[model samples]
Target: GEAGRAAALEGLERKVKAAMRSTTLNRLAPDLEALVRAETIAVQAGPRPSADESVLAEIRGAVLAGRPLSFIYSRPGAEARSRSVAPCGVMFGRANYLVAADRESGRIQTFRLDRMTSVEAGDGLATPPADFDLAAFASQSFGIYQDEIEDVVLRVTPQGATEARGWRWHPTQTLEDQPDGSVVVRFRASGMRELAWHLFSWGEQVTIEAPQRLKAVMAGELAAAGRALSRAQS
Candidate 1:
């Protein structure tokens, strides 16, 4: 009985993993699609960012074949340059990125798919490090951009405490209720600039409690806004 139960659990786990990997709406059953359409509405305000489908296909093939990739990449405000990297996987978020490692230096990096051109897979075999984990690598940053990680601490005022408690700020985040009806949220992450941008909307309800870098970035953003407002008034 125990062995039979274990086998059934393993089969169910495999099916769950397979379902999680199937992302497109077209993969949903007709009834499920109708239910989703009736219950959900996405309010995208602008054109959704996308990568070249052909380039994505080329990179996906290279990753699956354990081959290296060569492409010309153009970073923002920079000239285009040639690159050779070992494809690890693709991360789809606000934008699509190729998570890869330099063939020569072995340094892992993320390249935006939209900025890539003339993508070609190499004949030589290349693969991610045996211990490389795509999800763990992506989680190191608050958003897409990666930098030095820090212990981030925030204090949400009583007015926003309930909302903050219900929010999923980060995968590693933990919230603690304060005696004064406030809440303290703590998490370790990078991408301070992006975090600063998000904190702007919280107004006075959120207070930065640690990591001087985030505080400085928030202050800089506030000063820039102040200058823009003054110019508009003048």
Candidate 2:
């Protein structure tokens, strides 16, 4: 029911070529509708970050050509400015991002693809750092932004333990079955706030067992949320 990336791209190409042949909007409208609103083959776009495919395509091309990219990056409450960055790779997670090393600082950074403007590829081949690994860089953070990685341990209540067994908490997680019918989840990760927010959804079914930092974060988030609710009620 859901179209994969390759299939979706191919379908889009077909729709574009069909539109190009028509001279007027009314003339192209019918054919375009049929291609998109198919009767038998229902096309569904799966969960992926929204952005201009044109920009993504250009970056993909630059990566293949081993060339750097230039673009005006916008920061919140600040002016937009241009930067040349070595094209390391494009990472797709909750959102899409261009991960690279700033040509100035030589330190790696991530720019949200949606915030980029006036993108252009450099003439010279991109020279990434000798020891930079995209996977390693990404894995340093529990979610997106990097922080101190710590050993996180969570003990699931007996009632929720069965369901938690089927959950993939993390790629590098270890799950241990306790004789008391509860499960202990352990993993090394950063981004305590994100983890805390997620565990809130578990609704007391999950309990923190170690890493004082995670417990502190969870308590802080709970207190903040409580204060907001109190203010709203008052």
Candidate 3:
């Protein structure tokens, strides 16, 4: 049984190595490495103070036992704050372990593992609601933004479409070919800021459809640029 497990792992590694030979995966490999290195460096080259392993172990135990935790957390650019939350799940985001918490407001919150300064297990909090669905919660989410969901449709010109032919933007994305030698891509996203910026980078080759608001935002940006050019000429 042990030998069989080792062979299975080696087979999986080979498949991963084969997949990484593709262009998109190859480009992302370095960024993934950097993220891991950054997390390791933080843990290794820390100041005299280090995170308490006992606290971490207790937090893990609480999560497994469906208990709550109160901890001091500091946002990337904000002051440190105290929070009381019920532990739900732990997920790996890039190289960080994100702890999902059920807040007092009945909404779920995610906290970065490295940003937690102090953690303490608390008295038993209510377990996740009977109807709580983790898969649906993350279905339309792009990265961590989960405010509102929008139907985004993009028309990419032939050249741009060719560039995106085999790329996977999201699991639910649908790509269709249009008669005018352009490609139409449609997907539902909870956050559009990242996708909007990505489409904007394609310059005039991509057009935003369906959501008039996105087009309006792009038009305003172009108008501002025109005004800036006019001011410079004068």
Candidate 4:
């Protein structure tokens, strides 16, 4: 999918360059060529081909057409299951996700696109609920895992403020610069375990300021990790 999008962008760039070359007078050619070269290079960020392009296309077309879709899904430690869903929207980021309404539960669900073994159009078209907001749904979680949502607050030390200011923790994150040169970032999010794992990267630079549950989870994670290390050494 990325490859296709890149190719399309490249093709349009070529057309624009050809038109500019043919229409501009000789006096303006050098300036126009220089601008074109700069933009062309800027647009050439690396993108790769999708592993399951056809399956993605099937679900994408269904979502666009307000149609339902059926797919065979599988993941580690789980039985391969078949599902029918009312396609709502598709989200692409670090990994692609299919945001849809489950036919049985009638609740919105997110599916990893790569986990889908096969996808096809279902019989009747089903329009997504008017109240559904794909962006809001995805932002409900700190990471992809869906869990109890909590108000998360982190206090970054003065030493980590510069780097923390540049880091985006969530779509709804709020960063406040303290008078002491430290920074406090707050965001309401789900996936506590995932958040704890991410905070490990910040190490001693960050402290959990709110949500006692988050601090507990972080301690549990460290304890479990220590036990694992001990077992491995034994």
- Highest-scoring model, lDDT: 1
**Candidate 1 on 68-106: residue-level lDDT in tens?**
999999988999999989999988776778999878777
Would you give me the overall lDDT of model 1? 0.87
Ranking by lDDT: 1, 4, 2, 3
Measured against the true structure, the TM-scores of the candidates, in listed sequence, are 0.80, 0.72, 0.63, 0.79
Clash total of candidate 3:
0
Error of 3 at 66 (Å): 0.7
What would the per-residue lDDT of candidate 3 be over residues 20-129, giving only the tens digit for each residue?
75787888889989996888533443223333445557667777787778788897799999887776655444433344545656777667666786687777664665
Give a tens-digit lDDT track for model 2, residues 1-234: 113466788999779777674466668779879986776644444334645767877788887897889999998999998889888887886677898887767787888887899888879878678899989888766677657888999999999999899997877799999999999999988888888988998997999988999999999999999999999999
What is the lDDT of every predicted structure here? 0.87, 0.83, 0.69, 0.83
Better of 1 and 2 by TM-score: 1
Residue 48 displacement in candidate 3 (angstroms): 21
TM-score of 3: 0.63
Residue pairs with colliding backbones in model 1 are none
